[model samples]
Target: MKVPGTINSRNPNSQSVFENSFVKTLSIAVLMGIFLVDMGLGLFEIFSTKESPLPTAVVLLIFAVIFIAGMVFYEKQGLDTLSSLVGGALAGFGFSFVFVSLVGGVQFALGGGISTIGWDQVISAVAASMIASVVILKALSYKLQNHLY
Candidate 1:
């Protein structure tokens, strides 16, 4: 027997869970797409098709690590929305600058260096990082508010 206004659904929680998962997946893919396109355009001068695949892979790996680490740090720090976004931007800029600088330095020391990575790379990386963070946060926020309200 069931109350008229209190019917039970065997999978009552299923809808919210599925929706959350879908939103997370979609947001992540969008972030990744933007990051890849920006990286490709930014690095074209530094890496030609012949020598690209490896550096591109390495750079993206670093970005992924930074992205995850930044998210964890922001969550742990309990940063507000804007603070988290700014922190991400700063972290991304510093990480990109340092990573590329060291790489450029090594190549220079080896006497085969043809170019360097600089401000544009850092700016793009930072912007992409912040954008990704905000996107995830915004998606989660809406989902949470929907459930709560």
Candidate 2:
């Protein structure tokens, strides 16, 4: 009784459940939620704590999520590899810039009236994070290119 051009989820012979628009939108929303929550927690920890914001477990999780999502988007959108790399690298650099600045500011505020954090540390941390992000994302992107659905 299903229409020829309509999606029929109740029909056993219909397309995959994931092929539905709602499912796709929900999945994307969930992924975006994960990324947003992770960034929020990281920012909160950076400003409210004396510890480094770059927790290994948390950072690795974010990186994995970003890499997988980026690759999927790249494949779906037919994005140029070079543009993706550059865009991702710039994003990483911008994030690191903000993160390092907050960390440095916190350290300065908590140094008991002395500025313990120096520009060298901030520059080095930003550079290191930007380089690491680019390398990791590029490697993963290259390995997974055209291999994902």
Candidate 3:
């Protein structure tokens, strides 16, 4: 069994750098997709003048719950590490969405009516979540490779 490395080089599929990187890259892409879709819905609610922050909060909460269920299901496939990254990203997006839609709405609810949920915040949150997920999962995956396989 190989010891853990900074990056995941523990692809049980093949003992090659290319194979391990491919698996990690694919997993990262999946997590990114999940985050983008969830956050996009949150953004839609945030921008809708009639809906208010409540809808965005509800949507994010729903996503958080669903994400947990998804992880549980994926875990059985021996894909827990990949699943965890997706879960973390969903959480980050959910929190950022709620924070921007609710707390930032003070100005809008009061009158001057400024949108608190800017594209910048959404983009930054997505990037931050994706980056963190990759780092955390790569480290943990390398560590758990022996035990998992």
Candidate 4:
């Protein structure tokens, strides 16, 4: 019989540093910061241009590199892959919503008290961030797993 509050020696894969609440919260916060900054920059580049595709491509490349690097680092730390990915997506969504709301508030405050912010853009940003993070995480995880084995 396994005793409570004792490590299960039979389960080698049961060890997870991310199981700690503090560590998991910190990880989510880190992911949120990363998504905020990365997606913020990408959104800026995207909205700054209406006739250019090069900037968008550059943003995608930058995000890809960052996501791959993060995945490798997290994998090395033995974080659960599914949890990490889900956290990433949630972080992305949160960041997108916050960023857009802030921008809208700023615009309302500065532009003669007029609200010109588009809700569609905010929604699109949230969706894009969530979808992109999930896809990127999956691809990187697959590649990393293959390389390790």
Candidate 5:
């Protein structure tokens, strides 16, 4: 007999601990932390070196790895592709915006007076984030689906 308010360990339909929403949220939070660290470090590198290509490449590589890992994690949890895509995009945009603002604030503190932030820059960051999210989600979903079966 199943006890009230308690999960049945023998129940085949019962989800594992990792399949719970709490785990999902925790995983996403971890991914976001990774994203922020990667972005902050990448920005520091670019600013310190005054060279763009190498830093950009390194950042993209880090992003790609995280995206794939996130997608795989979500897939294992039975999350749909659309949800993953939207979640990834939102996380990316939010982090990117914060990163940009933080960089601007640091610059202001370092003798560069506060300047108006252009809407174009914000829009571009959002657009780039969304594009990257979509591409990563779609490609990973396809690969995961085929590999799982």
Candidate 6:
């Protein structure tokens, strides 16, 4: 049996230099900061526009690219299940927020006004995205652990 605090026994050879808890936490925090800033900029772009969808489209693209890059980095580094899950969840949550904001912006521009959008809608979207992301990550982790990936 493997020790609780030790590395995974199945992939004992897959250790990375960033296996330390502090480094992992710090890295995640930094990624979160980036996400928050990007999200803020996207929101600002949304509110500052009533004539073009280009800005929201660009924000959506950037969010997708950043999230994809982060996931790819984790995959290449062979990070543990927790790391992958947390990374996916963060990226998914951020993307969901940005996407929802973009939709709201479009609606506002199209005369839906602000009454149709509320914190409840945004929270629900984020929560649903978080749940879906966790489920997906868990399944992928299981597949990878079983060498089915």
- Model 1 per-residue lDDT tens digits across residues 1-149: 76555657355545664378768666665666455434444355245433432366677777767766776688679998777766776676568645664554344434433225455664566567657766777788898988954
The per-residue C-alpha lDDT of model 4 at residue 16 equals 76
Model 2, 22-113: lDDT tens digits are: 67655555544434333443455566665664565755555555555665566567778876665555555565545554544444445532
Residue 129 in model 5: lDDT: 54
| Each prediction's whole-model lDDT (CA) | 0.59, 0.55, 0.60, 0.54, 0.55, 0.59
Candidate 4: TM-score? 0.31
Q: Best-fitting candidate, measured by TM-score? A: 1
Q: Is candidate 3 or candidate 6 better by lDDT?
A: 3
* CA deviation > 4 Å runs, candidate 6: 1-52, 55-115
Model 5: lDDT of residue 116: 37
Candidate 3, residues 1-149, lDDT tens digits: the string is 55677365565665765458778676675677445534454455457654555556666776676667666756666676777668656665665555555443443434433235555665665666777667777788889986855
Error of 4 at 10 (Å): 21
Candidate 2 Cα errors over 4 Å, as ranges: 1-12, 55-91, 94-149
lDDT of 3: 0.60
What TM-score, computed on C-alpha atoms, does each candidate reach?
Answer: 0.35, 0.33, 0.33, 0.31, 0.31, 0.30
- Angstrom error of the Cα, residue 10, model 5: value is 8.2
Q: Which ten residues in a row have the lowest lDDT in candidate 6?
A: 32-41
